[model samples]
Target: MKCFQLVRSVLDEIYSEIPLQDEAQKDKAIKDEILSLRSKYAKLLSSSRVIDYENPITRFSYIYSYVTSHANIVYNIIESSDMLCALMDSKKVSMTSIGGGPGSDLLGVIKYLTNASKSPTLRCNLYDRESAWGESWSDVDNKLENPFKISIYFQQFDVGEPSTWVRHVKYLSSDLFTMVYFMSEVFGNKTTAEPFFNNLFANAKKGALFLYADNNTPDFYNWFDELAHRNSLITIESTSKNFNVNYDEEKTDLGIYYDKFGFPKLTANIAYRICQKQ
Candidate 1:
């Protein structure tokens, strides 16, 4: 499937269930909510606990702005990486996406697999603290079409709490683990977050793939790089670039909201790293 087609389909699915009365109303609501949530999300990146993602509207706002943008970036990263291509060629693949709310990473994976014409039986586990995201992602899963089987499991797991990490032990034995735009969110509480990441890398199966993508923040990139080094994960590839999104092409209220907020254009400075457990 073409990238834009996949995006349109996913956006359509999300928009259909947004519980809005009309397009204009939805656009205004999303725009207002996105502005408010963007401030809170920014605080979250800085480690402030001022925002609550438990609210459905907050999650919806995030989905409209960051999720679509991140999904596009992930698709581009996978499309351009030979390592990712080889990884997707497997007949059976398991992937885990930490902080993968509402299927952004999953959609990116699906787009890659479909375009590559590799019909691997895929099992994806999406872990997030907000359980409501599970419902939205399940809706997305049901809407997708694939030649082979794909199963998505949603878990309400908190990465900050060490006690909750054990429940994910079984799912950690995955072919690939993705942390898209997640590290920045947790980096604020490094004291607590470090142990979880340390344990994750230490316990992951040998030869497993790890994909880390986030904003082009030096601190965030350095934190993950340090963890990779400490865990002896071999860095296969890493790059930083501008991730631009054409808001005009968006077929949902997101586009309208962007235009309304004077963000007729959108671009993100992103960095990505690919590593393999040694």
Candidate 2:
């Protein structure tokens, strides 16, 4: 199967396992949780409390709506960037995605590598507080015919509690690091997050690549830029773009939620930066 199709299939299988309830009741619950998550997501960088994804439905809703939407846009952004092209050309690449749940960043990297006809052995580590996501994503990974010889390791680390984030130290010094829709989630606690990011930059191999993609907001981008400057990471390229994404009705479960919730074709206002630790 094609890469995109595989993503859809994997998600379908995972969602299928979720026990069925009244369709209307389930939709309402999912919608309510989605709205709550959206509100919490916007304030994440500033909020002192951690946003919960412990609920299975909340996790599923996130993957169904937010994760899939951002993944599509992120895939497009990576595909169009020359900097990423050069980085992915290496024979072997190590990558880590902070707050990477259920493999959105992984899928994007896989898409790019497959399209470029580059079969690099990818060692990917996904860090998130939600350990359940690791199981769901691993199921998907096991079902795929991996062209890149990708191996994924999931680390259950809470970005909100940097004091307990020691597990990630061994995974530093990677060739690439991705923060797709992630900084905004933890930016509210910049004081707590700074040390982790600083340590990451300090330990990253020289010339290691960093990809930051998120909602195109001045405050968010400014925050990331500040971090880059503080760590002496050099910005290679930065750009913002607006694009519309349409969901496939039959190919993915995402369409079911979109239709139930009356979600429009997503207009993604996204900003991305490629930097290298100097």
Candidate 3:
């Protein structure tokens, strides 16, 4: 029920599937992967490069390093947003997550619903460019002891390609839409990403709620506001703040890897917005 539960599940998947010669190798492998990824992200603040996700090592490395903090940041944003909370009042609610491969977006929402003890039936659709990430999170709902009826579906979505996203219309029905750290991820390819957002906002149903949480940078947050403005989405709240990963020590479950890599991202500097389609 807690978000850490989801974090443990990711670690479990990595331990089970990734092949290593020995415990020492795992320590080296995970540590090396994390450092390489860490360096890439650090430089990404200034430039853009498409990260390869086909490698299992790369994907798992991302899971170990970023998902935890991103999920927590999302939980903090929704916990403070009354508009997102209102969706829980419905008997059945749906959400669509753009670039949700890391599983942070849904895990964050799951954590909130558990903490609130609200058990409305929830449907989740994750749209991302990588089909490989689909399997990484396929067993999540099964692993977590969800109090509510929950179902998830993954669709291959390329933000730079309109051919892929245009075919998918079911997402338009979602009561909520999440773009957690997604804009920043695709910030380099804004030329193509913009059309995708344009079509999405122009067609999304009136009254649909949107949550945008990402880096506290002008390129990221400013791009979000421009699309919202073009679409006429009513802004509920928009601000940039610092958030720490509020984790329970008892729930921590990384075994040897914990000692190898000190911890995943424990804090984030974010600019977030809660809006309603009008």
Candidate 4:
């Protein structure tokens, strides 16, 4: 089986661990379990794939391949809304991306922000624990040719660890608009997202806008919806687009499910939330 299939299998087993409740508790028991699972997943991804970066073309082929399928739709969705553009451009904004995956999503957000009239001084930060496993991972220094020179910082840390966040919070402070985007599956059995968000908003300024984006997989979709409803964070925008599936069809780690019928083999189903600290 391919790497992603292995991930999917692990996820299937772990999915049952997430609780279903209108008001779920962020307990030590939950946090520890998720953290343990995250470590296992990290090891699995790192060991299974040997990323070919010797050739520039070969390195970009996968990224380019995925982008050609998903980027346009994601761009269009982001561009069509004034509220989202505002959220991205809020002055004194401090955004932290979790599981951002080599910074493609930030690149997309920065592209939109640069095109708009508001040239806000943005201090962006990206967080990930996968850097030790692969050199291809993203950080603050990862650059793209752009008109907007947004200052971005990358911190390598695991989202599963509560202690790692002490430095993260100190770096971000409490007075900035904080946004955390999860492009990958960050809601598995081992994730510290709930506590982080709970603590983050408690210390945030009143106008802080937090956005979390994840695929519409059954586990994540349910998790995101529950968090949004419980937290009083209104859904400013929610939509789906034609996205690409990263794993090959023949690879068979996970089935196409509903995607098999569509002309575009992959689709990016995204959800956005704009919240006021109350």
Candidate 5:
């Protein structure tokens, strides 16, 4: 798997640098190619009867390390230590994660709090739809308890239907502590996301702190920022950083390995936005 991934990464780097009319054209072509590859892989995996589980490549330690390193980019850029310490000292925080991939974001925040103080107790209410990994939500919760050593509630909730889920989230988070971290799962598709955000803004209380990190794209950034401005939510900070591994120099193309159809390059910019509800 590592060999395949490395080869794929190299190929993707080469394909990405393939001459195009301009940057815009390059992005469009890559975007289209990514979609096409996704469809192709979906069919191939299904045919091979491995579609129900997380891709083997995604589970490799190196791949997760690469992902977590990117996640820390948001943590380093956002100055949440003081607020996290305050919340920990109080021993009460209503934190929720939307699309918390395998609970990495939740665990990262819990580690920050635990390391900052003396055995801080925290309340994390997680929300995520079923992930491709057959590892159910319970698996993530179990791993978190031993490391962070705190009380955590794991619940399967879909962010797209904020009406059904937001009320529960509000009830779970009814006091001086509120932090919401959401990721790519919600905003990747615009049509479904618009209503979800509308419901979220209406349901969320004032003074709530929100952190969203996702694959960067102009449309996602523009729409979310616009909504923040309209709702009086102050944008505390925003950051864009590349998460792609440089593979172009190897003169390879990973896309060709996917039975002629899987997205070869996993290049994505992890962009984060910190906001406070007014």
Candidate 6:
């Protein structure tokens, strides 16, 4: 199976793990959770409150609606950036994904590597506040069919509690760093999130490449720009574009879920940037 197909497989597996007994009850549960997540995001857009990803339904809500599109977005950005393309060709790649417990960030890099037919050993650290998110992608290596090995670690990070972030020094060694749709999630708590970014830029390896993709809005991009600016990260290329996944490239595997949740996010207006800490 292809790397992007692995994303769909993950969604299928997570769907099975939902706490529902039968078809009817599962349908009801999925619909309700999707609505609840939408309401929570609406509130998050307007307030400082953080959603509880530890809640199983909320977590599933985000994974179902977003993981595939997000993975696709990050893959596009990575494949287009010359520095990341060069990194993909390296013998090994070390990356830290901030708030990337949903698994999209790593999947994107896998997709890029798979398409390029370059299977470098992957060392990835996916950090998030919700420990529960780790279970969702634990089997990623099992799903990948490449010759190279992959190493994935999940580090608990709480944006509201900066201490959890400051104590971690190992992530500073990453050759690439990604923040995919993560800025807006903790935007209201910038005071807490800002320090982590500062420490990240201050200590990251000199040749690290940073990839950022989020909603095409200043509320998100401005924070990314400010961090890159103060840190003197050189921009490779930056633009806003409407990216759509080639849904037809893969078979229609989301049939049942589509009937319930309308459809997964196939397209998104995303602002993306690729920067190098030279």
Most TM-score-accurate candidate: 3
Residue 133 displacement (Å), model 1? 0.4
Pairs in clash, predicted candidate 5: 8-254, 10-252, 11-252, 11-253, 11-254, 12-254
How do all models score by TM-score? 0.86, 0.86, 0.94, 0.56, 0.57, 0.92
- The residue-by-residue lDDT of candidate 2 on 108-154, one tens digit each, is 77766766687888888998878878876665556666554878888
Query: What global local distance difference test value does model 3 have?
Result: 0.81
TM-score quality measure for candidate 1: 0.86
Q: Candidate 3's residue-wise lDDT over 1-278, tens digit each?
A: 45555676677776666677687786677778889888877666566798887666777788877887888887777788777777876789899999997788988888888788888898999899998888777767677665568888999999899889888887988899999988888887788889899888888888899999987988789989999998898999999899988855232565555666777777888889998888
Each model's Cα RMSD:
3.3, 2.9, 1.7, 14.0, 11.6, 2.0
Predicted candidate 4 versus true structure: per-residue lDDT over 1-278, tens digit per residue = 12232223333332333243421332233334334433543443224332332332322232322322233333445577775666656575555555544444454555456445545566666565544213332222233333344666667665557787755655445222323334234454324557665556555555555555444444555566566567665566565444444333232433441132122224555444444544
- Clash count for candidate 6 is 0
- Candidate 6 or 3, higher TM-score: 3
The C-alpha local distance difference test score for the whole of candidate 6 amounts to 0.80
Q: Encode model 6's per-residue lDDT on 1-278: one tens digit a residue.
A: 34336656766776677677786887777788888776776565567887777766667678778787888888788777777888999998999999999998988888788778888889999999989898777778887665468989998888667778878888899999999988888888888778778878888989898998888888789888998899898888889999998553443565556667777667898899988887
lDDT scores in order: 0.76, 0.73, 0.81, 0.45, 0.47, 0.80
Output the number of the lDDT-best candidate: 3
Instruction: Tell me the lDDT of candidate 2.
Output: 0.73
Candidate 1 colliding pairs? none
Residue pairs clashing in model 6 are: none
TM-score of 6: 0.92
Q: Taking the candidates one at a time, how many backbone clashes does each contain? A: 0, 3, 0, 6, 6, 0
